[model samples]
Target chain A: MYDGIVQDLIDELGRLPGVGPKSAQRIAFHIIQTESFDVDRLATILQTVRERVRFCIICGNIGEEERCAICRDPRRVPTAICVVEEAKDVVAIERTREYRGLYHVLGGALNPMQGIGPDQLRVAQLMTRLQDPTVEEVIIATDPNVEGEATATYLIRSLLPLGVRVSRLASGLPVGGDLEFADEMTLGRAFEGRRTVER
Target chain B: MYDGIVQDLIDELGRLPGVGPKSAQRIAFHIIQTESFDVDRLATILQTVRERVRFCIICGNIGEEERCAICRDPRRVPTAICVVEEAKDVVAIERTREYRGLYHVLGGALNPMQGIGPDQLRVAQLMTRLQDPTVEEVIIATDPNVEGEATATYLIRSLLPLGVRVSRLASGLPVGGDLEFADEMTLGRAFEGRRTVER
Candidate 1:
């Protein structure tokens, strides 16, 4: 809808993960109109990230070095490893400040319908990490959806023979949410997992 | 929420026009995971756009040359110039294939509340363009909102002295839209601008 170079810019912006056509147009125009916007700096950052960033060899999480920050940190618990579906999941868990263990990104969960199975994920790397006798437990923090549950179940089966404790993250009504608006599955989980209140 | 370089990438992405924190995180993860996505090409396009592209000297639209594609096209009707609020509006009108003429981007609408006045836009350039005796008409295609209306009114007043025919794009119920769902202002305009049917 524009000259070659302008159209090229829009097309490249549209190729990003979530930018739709209208949004891409808006952003392209924004870049064109805003005189103070430093497009060259953004370009340099993109180039640098592509050139320097790499996945951690120990886990699948992103890092500029050989291993992820959590994996390199001495304070992170070596005995406990939380398995998550993506690197973004590691960020989300980190925001909670509750967990102090290392992470292993599975890239994605097992979705047989989508042709993603245990072999497609970083499951083998996880199993190898578990080979150490010092590691006492593996926490499956995959999503509560069908694919995530399937992946967690498969991991449990694989880890049973290794004699390490395996646990799944809890699924229930979210905090600050009312019971009336909770979905059926969440309401049921809330009931099944109810704990005694201490006075 | 991530390692140093990954966090820096997210921060830069978040500074873009419409990307929020959550969207920034999502795009960062997508860039990291999709090995096939050509980040280098995107970076190159961005750099090229910054270094090579500039606004058309004649119309204020983005262009690789001194004049935009429309301004350079020999076949475009020179007499009819479509006045729009931004470069994005040029793209929207071009998609319709209805306006076969030149364009004059005002850069922004008049919003006195925000301290934007005629001097802020390319209004002076628009008036200077009308000095050419061959130009016969100026079509005001600014937005339908209050700020757009104010800008159009100001342009109409400014162009009256030049004796060139000043027109406005019709505003009413949109094509394929239900009359019942039309807003009161649009429904009122639709009745006010009712045209006689030809037999």
Candidate 2:
């Protein structure tokens, strides 16, 4: 489709999660045509990210330091650890400003079809973290999908014997969403989790 | 939304064409999480593309050397020169395998709203290329939209005096496209350019 190095650039760019071939070509051309585009800077950052970024030792979250920002922050409540499937989920929770507790990233949810079992996840590290006497509750904030639910179920069974309180994130229709558009499963969940309004 | 360098990487990726903030974050996280992902390779290619690729001196098409592949290829018909709006457009036409002529990249279309006119394009270079005694035809393959039509119109006016056979890529409903969904302008063009059966 394109010359040697140009085609190579497009192929490499297309390897990213969502970027397809057309997008890769468009991006490659943009980098080539836009004189003001900082190609060196982008390249340098990519190299730096690869070199400097690493998973936190305590939690599976990504950061430059040994421990993630949430784990390092003294103000975050250590008693309640919110467990999520990935580091990106931690960022999503952080944006809400609702949860002021620590996080434990599982790296990924369990998917038996992909051969990703409990051992493949950071479950062992999470269990080890729960041994601390001060930590009281574990919040299973994994995604509401099938794999996430299975992972949450496994974690709940494992943590119940340890005498720690376990809770899963509620699933229901999203706020400000049209009820008519809500799928049957979600509508059912919303009905089951209905709470009385306080005046 | 993310930590220092991670956020910076996301911002840089978001600057690319068609990449939004969420997609940038997803790509950044993929790079961070997947150790097998060739970050260094991608970075090196980015640097190489910026350092090596330059527009062809003969026509404005992009290449690693002074002349583009088409311009250097002796097998191509030297008598016909196809004029295109961008280097990408040249690739599109090449894939069709219908044209074997040389190419002259205009870099962009004539858009008065954006302050782009004949001066901003490679019009002079095209005119100079037309002066070759062996060149017999000049095909305008600019896009079908407004700016492309304006550029084709401008080129037609400029090339008519030089006695070169000036022509334009036909406008009409695309092949295999739904005629019912075709716009009025396209339908009009199709009617105006209707060819007679040669039986």
For model 1 the interface RMSD, in Å, equals 1.2
In every candidate, how many clashes are there?
0, 0
Candidate 1 residue-wise lDDT, A44-157, digit = tens: 777777788888999898888999888999999899888888887777667556678888999898988889988999999999998888888787777666677778778888
For residue B18, give model 1's deviation from the true position in Å: 1.7
Tens digits of lDDT, candidate 1, B14-48: 88878998788778777877888888888888777
Clashing pairs in 1: none
lDDT (tens digit, per residue) of candidate 2 on A64-120? 899988889999998988888889877766765667778899988899999999999
Candidate 2 residue B40 C-alpha distance from true site, Å: 1.2
Instruction: State which docking tier applies to candidate 1.
Output: medium
In order, what DockQ does each candidate have? 0.65, 0.75
